[model samples]
Target: MSSTQEFIDEAAKIYKVLSNSTRLKILYYLRHQDSETDVKTMVNDLGLVQPIISKQLGILYRYQLVCRHKEGTRVYYVLDDPHVIEMIDDMLKHVKHEIKGEPHPRTLYDNKK
Candidate 1:
């Protein structure tokens, strides 16, 4: 594969991380939050157990899609690039349009007036 194909292949790996519902929910929450959070915090905020969160986080970290920082004994994570947030925001817009008032659905609205 050429360099461009290699880059696309790497991007596909990143997509694999985002492909999981739990992982995407985790990223969506963390990215929108104003402050960074540690694994324990992620477990609590996501209502997921420590081990599952850790495993998902490991995948995200491996792809360099997440930023990790240590303060004291706890490690906090943030988005490696702000563009990830932008991407999520763009997708959320489409989701909102697709699910608007639909039964048994997820809905999001932007107050960008």
Candidate 2:
């Protein structure tokens, strides 16, 4: 396979991981936090069950999207990449503009004159 195809395949895998709403929520939650958060706190704050949060956290950790540390009996997680949050924020801005029927702000990739 060519390098371009390899890049596309890897990008698709990342999008697949980010496509989960639960994972997105977890990312967003971590983004606003000042420190590492435990699964139990996420379960309580996000109103999700422990297993579901744990599973999603595992996936996020595997993707290198979140970092984790084990202290005592609890495992805490924090956002590993701010770039991921920025991407999500930009997409959300695009979505908001779409919903409001507003023009999209010009990006570096915009080709219009």
Tell me the tens digit of each residue's lDDT in model 2 across 47-108: 99999999999998998999999999999999999999999998999999999999987777
lDDT of each: 0.80, 0.94
Of candidate 2, the 10-residue stretch with the lowest lDDT total is: 104-113
Top lDDT hit: 2
lDDT score of model 2? 0.94
**Candidate number of the best TM-score:** 2
| Model 1: residues with Cα > 4 Å off, grouped in runs | 100-113
Per-residue accuracy of model 1 over 27-81 as CA lDDT, tens digit each: 8877778888898888887889989888888888887778888899888998777
Q: Give the per-residue Cα lDDT of candidate 2 at 98.
A: 96
